[model samples]
Target: MNKLFKLVRHLTMSLFAMATLIGTTANAERLLTENFEYELGNLYSQGGWLKYGTQAAGPVQVTNNALTYPDYQDKAVGKAVHLTQVASGEDLMRAVSETAISSGKVYLSALVKVNAVADDQYFLAFIQPTSAGIVDKKTPPENTRLIASKGSVDGKFVFKISRNSATLFESTEEFELGKTYLVVMSYEFKEGTKNDVVQLWVNPAVASTEPKPNAAINSATHTGADMKSFQAIELRQGSSATKVGPEVIVDAIRVGTAWTDLFDVASTEPTMTVTPTVVYDGSAVAIGSSTTFATYAVEYANLENPIDVYLTGANRNQFEVSAETIPAGSGKATITLTYKPQAIGKHTARINFESTVSTLNTGFAATGIAWDPENPPMIVAHSEGLTPFTCKAGEQQKQTITVTTSDLPDYGKAAVKGLSNGAFIISTATLLKNGNTQINITFKPLVPGDYEEVIEFSGIKATTETIRITGTATENGTTEDREGDRLPLDDSKP
Candidate 1:
C-alpha cells in the first residue's frame, strides 16, 4: 500500500511540474531585457550612445541613489540629452528577455525625459525577430519605425496612445528574440495642447492600471534613474548567441517576460496642432514705471512690420513705481505691471507682460496668446519707425525689421504681417540683454517689376511703412544705390 501511494504521489508531482512549465511559457511575453548596464561611467564605460552636451553629459550629482539636473534650466528650446560637465557617459542597452518567443513578437518601452527642450529624432532597434542581436548602424525610416517623436516647431514632448496602438510607436523595426535596443533619444510636443503635463513614475508596469487615457501615454509614469552604474546580469545558456563580440555595458539588468500584443500605434506621431511653450511664464506681467516723456499704454509695438511678435507690453494708463529693474534674486526683470488708477490695496496690480522680445532691431512677438483684459491681460502690437532698406526703379536695397522703443506713446509690441513673402527672408532677429530686438529683414525682389514692400506694424494701433524696390536679373548696386524719394523716417523709402 505504501509503495502504491508513493508511486501515485510521484506521478502527481510530475504532472504539476509540466503544468508550471506551460504556464511560465505562456506568461513570458510581457518582458523587457538588455545587456547594457545603466550607469554614468566615464569614456571607459559609456560607448556609442549620443550626447546632448549641456554644461556637460549627466549622471548629474546624485545622493542616496537620486539623480537631478543641477544646471538644466536653459532657453534654447531644442529637446536634447543633457550632459552634465562631469558626466562621463550613460548606459544604453539592447534586447534580452526572460522567455523564448517562438512567434517572435515583443512589447518594448523605455524611460524618457526632457531637460529644457524636446527631441529631434530618436529610435529603438528590436533586432532579428527570430534570434537575439542588435542593430548597430541607424536604418532609414523606410527600414525602421520610430517609437518616439522629436520636438515640434513650437516646443515640448508628447506621448499618446491609439486604439490597440500607442501615440508614436512605429513597426518598421524588427524584433529579435531575447534582444532589445536601449535607445537614448529625446522628444517634445507642440504647445497649447489641452491638459498637458509632464512627470516621472518609477513603476512603469503599474501605470497600465490607471484609468484609460485618450491614448497610450508613455509618460503616464516614470521614475528618474538612480545615479550609479547598474551591474551586469546573469543569463541562461544560449542567451549569448553563438557569436559573442563587441564592447558592451550592463547595469540593473532585470529579466522580464515579453508578450507581443501588437501595440498598434501609427507609423508616426501626429503633426502637432498645438502651439509651443514660449508664452507661458506662470506669472502675471508687471509693467515698469513711466519715465516723464515716455508714455505708457495697454499696448506698445516696435516701428517695423514683417515681424509677428512686435516689441509690445500691457498696462497703459501710465504707471509709476521703482522704474524698470529686476527684483532682487530674480533672474528676470520685474517691472511693475500696475497701470490702473484703482491699483491701490493690492499694493500692486498683477498685469502686463512681455509680448515681443525686441532684439537685433527685430520684433520677436510671443508665439500665440490673444489679448484679453478680463481673463488674462494681453497687449496689442503695431509697427515702428525704422524698417529695412529697399530699392527703386533701378536702385537695389533690402528690407529690414527694426524695433523703436527709443520713444514712448509710440510703443507697443510690433506685429508685422504679409512679411513672410518670398522676397523678404529673415536673416537675424538678435535680442540682446534687453536691447533692441532687431530682425534683419532681407528682401530679394522676385522679378524686374516694381515691387512695393509695405512693412506694416499692427497691435493696439496700426501703421504702415512702405518701401518700393525694383527687381532686375542683373545685380549692380552698392549700399549707396538710390532712386525714388527717401522717407527720413527710414532710408529704405524708395
Candidate 2:
C-alpha cells in the first residue's frame, strides 16, 4: 500500500504539460471560463479535470472564503476555485481541454486573485502529452513549454515564462494583496533563431473598484526552439507543494484566437517614436580620430510589449547601440552615435531603426579635419615669477596659477606634480576653452616649509612648456612680521 501510494502521486504529477487546443471561433472562442457556483467536494477529479494527489494530502476546491471583501468579491462572479498543495511531494491540479490550439498564434486570459504565494507556482499554457507518470521538475518532458505562470518571491508577485526547460522571461511588476489581475498572454511562434515572440498584459479592463493593470511587458525572441502547439492550461505549484505553499483563487479563464475576443478592450497597433531626428558632432572630427555625435531615444507608443529594432543603413557601422532589446512597457530606449572619419572631407550617413511595426532613419553629419604636420598650434602664456605663502604649522594656504593659449585647433593636456615631500599639493586644475584656452591651477600648502613644483603641458603639436611654482610657509605670527605672507594675484604683473 505504501509503494502504490507513491506511484499514484508521481503518475498524477506527470499528467500535466500535454494536450492541445484546436479549432477557431469566428469571433473569439471562450475555451474555458469557470466561476465555480457549485460545491467542489471532488471537483478536481470529476469536472473534466485530471489531477495528481488525494483529498487528504491536497485538493483544489471552490470556496467563498477566498474572496469576501466587497471590492474583489463582487467582481469574482461568486465563488472561485482555491488551488493548494499540502503534500511534501509533487502536487498538481490541472484540466486538459478537449480542444488544442493548432495555430502558431493564440491568446490566454485569466482573472486571478493572489491570496498567498510561497515560492513558485504555475498558471500555465503549455504543450505536453496526457500520459501517465511523474516527471521530474529539473528534467521535464521535451517541448514542455510553460507559456506563462504567476509566482511570488520575497513577498512580491511575479509573472514567469519558461520554454524548452529554461526560463525565457519574468515580469518586474509586483502584485497587490486582495486585488484581482486580469492577465492576458499573447504569443506567436516561428521557426528560426530568436524569432518566437511572447507578451503579457495585465488588467486590460479596470473594474470600477480595482486599480488599473500593469502596462504591457514582452520578451525578446526566445533563444531556443519554437514551441509546438498549445496543449493545456494548468495551475501547478513548484516545490511550493509543501504545506507552506500558497492559497490562490482563479476565475474567468478564457482562451481565444483574437485579442478582442479575450480582452474587453481591443489591442492597438505598435507605434514607433524616435527623438532628435538629426545628429551632429559638435566640432569637426579629426581624421583617424572619433568623436561622439549625440545620444538619442527610440520609443514605443500604444504597444505595451517589448520588441527589438534592427539597425541598418550606411553609417550604422559608425554607431554603437547600448541594447537592442527594449524591455516591455519601457516605452523608450536610447542609442549613442560616434563619428570616426577615415578620410578628410565632409560626410553624411543615414542610420535606420527597423522593427515589425515601423522603420525610422536619421541623417548624421560630420566634418573631418586633417592635421597640419608642419605648422602645429602652440600654447602661449607668461609664467608666475614666484608663489609665496605663510600659514600656521598645520594650516593650508591656497595659490592660483593660470596659463593662456592662442587660437589653435590642437591642444594638449596639463599636469602638475609637487616636488616637496607631502608639503605642496595641487588642489584643482581646470581647462576652459573658448576661441582660446585658459588653464587654471590651484595649489595648497600642507605644512610649514619651503617648496617648489612644476606644471608641464605636453602632447601639443608644438614643443612642451613648463612653469615653475615656489612657495614658503612659516609659523603663524603677527601680521607685521609676515612680509611676503600671501600669494600674489598675478606675479607676472610686476
Candidate 3:
C-alpha cells in the first residue's frame, strides 16, 4: 500500500511539471520571425509578405549577404533584404499577428546596417490590419516608426523613433556604415487616448531578460492618433520628397509580446536582386497639351528572351511609354515617356520592363506637372535691380521688397547668396493671385565694411528672380534705406 501511494504521487507531479513547461513555451513563442531563408529574388510575395503603395515603387530585393551580431540567437542564419532610396524602391509589409495587439506592449528586434544616409525618413513602421483586404497604398496609422537621417559627423548615420506620425526622437550617438547593430523597439499601449509611449534601444545585450531602463531614445509625449491596434510591420523605402537612406540592409526581424520571447529561443524563417530603378522629374507643362517629358534607355544584358513592358500607377493613363517590348539581345533601347494631363495638377507613373529573367527586368519613374496656360504660376519681384542701403556698425537696418504675382497664388522662397556672416536676413512670403506681398529684408553688420547680397526668389513653376542688395556699413553713419527704380517685366520659362 505504501509503494502504490508513492507511485501515484510521482505520476501526478510529473504531469504538472509537463503542463507548466507547455504553458511557458506557448507564452514565449515569437509572434513573427523572419530571416529571409528563401531563394535570392524579390521580397514581394515571398513568406507572406506583400507589396503596398504605388507599384511604380520597385520591390525590395533579398540580397545574398547576411547580417550578424554578438549573442544574437539568429545571427547569420539566412539572407537579408536590401532597401534603397535609389529611384523610390519598394515598400513591403507582412502580418506579424493574425489579431490586433491592443493592450499589451509589443516588442520588435532586428539587425540593421545602414550603407548610406540621406534626408530624414522613416524606414520601418507598424500598421493596423485591415479586413477589407491588404492595407491600402495610402499609408495607414503608423505606430512605432524607425527613422534614419544624416549624422552630425560626416560618413555616419543615426537612428530615430517616432510615435505615430509625431516628431522624431533621435539617438544621441551616430552609427557608422558597414557595421551591423542590434535594434530593439517597444510600444506600450496605455489605457487612455494619446498616452501611449515608445522606446528604442541600440546594441542592447540580447542576453538581458528585460529592456534597459535608459533607452537610447524614447518618446514620452505622444502625437498623432492613438493606434487602436497593430497587426503588421511595414518596410518603407520612402519617396523622393521624404527620401530614406540610400542603402539599408536588414535581417533577423523578430516580433514578440515580451523581450524574452525575442532572445530566449531560436527560430528559422524565410529575394530578388534587382538593379536600381530610375526617377525622372519632368518640367511643368500647360494643361490640355501633351509633351514628351522624358526619355530613358534601358539596357538588357544576358537576355534569355524578349521582354514586355508595362506601366502602373493611378496616373498611368496620363503617361504613355514608347516601347511595349524589348527584343532579346545584349543592347540598349531608348524608351520615350509622354505626359498628357486632362486635368491640372501633378501626375506620376512608372514604366516597368518585365521579363522572365527577373534580373533583366528594370523600370524608371515618370513625373510631370500640368498648369493652366492663361493663369500660369508666376511670381515677380517689383524692386530695383540693385538696392543700396547705409547702416552703422552694430546697428540693424530693415527694408521691404514688394512682390507681385499673376492670377495664380505662389509661395515665394527667399535665399541669400554671397553672404554667410549673418549680415542679411530675408523672410519668405506667400503671394496671392493678382495681389502683392511685402517681404522684409534686414541687414545687420557686425564690423563696419561694405556688404553685398544677391537675394533670389523662387516659386513653383515660376521663373526665378534675383535682387542685388548692396550695403555700406560705417562706424558712425546713420541708417538709410533707398529703394531702386522698378525694372521692366521680364517673361521667361522656369
**What tens digits encode model 3's per-residue C-alpha lDDT throughout 298-378?**
655656566676787788888887878878756677777778777556677887776554433467677777668777677
Candidate 2 to truth, TM: 0.38
lDDT of each model, Cα atoms only? 0.28, 0.51, 0.72
Candidate closest to the true structure, highest TM-score: 3
**Residue runs of model 2 more than 4 Å from their true location after superposition:** 1-26, 52-56, 65-78, 85-97, 123-127, 130-155, 206-221, 240-245, 263-494
lDDT of 2 by residue, 367-441 (tens): 323333333445544555444555665666665555554323444456766566555555334333213344444
lDDT of 1 by residue, 306-331 (tens): 21211233423333333432222212
Model 3 ranges off by over 4 Å: 1-27, 73-75, 131-133, 136-138, 213-220, 265-494
Question: What TM-score do all the candidates reach, one by one?
Answer: 0.22, 0.38, 0.47
> By TM-score, highest first, what's the ranking?
3, 2, 1
lDDT at residue 185 of model 1 (Cα atoms): 16
Return the lDDT, model 1, position 464.
29
